[model samples]
Target: MGVWLVLAGLNGAMAIGFAAWGSHGVEGEAARWVGLGSQFQLLHAVALLALARFCAKRRRLFRPAAGLMVVGVALFSGSLYLKALGISLPIPMVTPLGGISLMASWLLLALAGWLACDHARV
Candidate 1:
């Protein structure tokens, strides 16, 4: 959890840097991609922080949710950042996989909330 919090902070800082760079240094399509990636990265970093807060109490659910979110943000935003910087890799499939993982993380979060509510009722 501590480690995740640190990661979230780092990610948030990186997002700010990327957004600034996109706005001031880049132009056109590259700027758009960088800005979009920074937005997603920052949003997910916030999510990661929230998940970290609850994970110790609900490891069965939040743990996996956090893991999925971390990987999803890394892959999704990472691919976009790479593209924006004009770097091409062999594996183009990772971006979509990251999207799927991000969607799955949301489902897990909902389930975790449901279970928490059920447990509270008991």
Candidate 2:
């Protein structure tokens, strides 16, 4: 619970910081990277907050979803941030992997919701 909350807060702050940089401190390709990264990061940050709340009631089901979200953000947004700063990782597939992870997280979240609802009806 605490971990999720902390991660949410941190991601929110980082997203804002990157957005600010994108808007005022950079231009061209760098700005694009920051813009995209910050947008996804902020969206997921808010989602994580909601997930944290849900975890209080369905910790078993939602925990994996939250974990995957974290990883997705770190990899996807982290790679974009690096690209913005003109740093490229040797691994070219990291950004795609991150996107896939994010998609998986959402799927897991849906599954968790289905399972939780099923259990509730039982």
Highest-lDDT candidate? 2
Superposing all C-alpha atoms, what RMSD in Å does each candidate have to the true structure?
2.0, 2.1
Global lDDT scores for all candidate models: 0.89, 0.92
TM-score of 2: 0.92
Worst 10-residue lDDT window for candidate 2 reads 113-122
Q: How do the residues 3-122 of candidate 2 rate in per-residue lDDT, one tens digit apiece? A: 999999999999999999999998998999999999999999999999999888866758888999999999999999999899989997999999998999899888877876757557
CA lDDT, candidate 2, residue 94:
98
Q: Over the stretch 1-122, how does candidate 1's per-residue lDDT look in tens digits? A: 79779878988999999999999988999999899989999999999899888886756989898889989989998898999889996986988988999999999999987876857557
Steric clashes per prediction: 0, 0
Per-residue lDDT value at 58 in model 2: 65
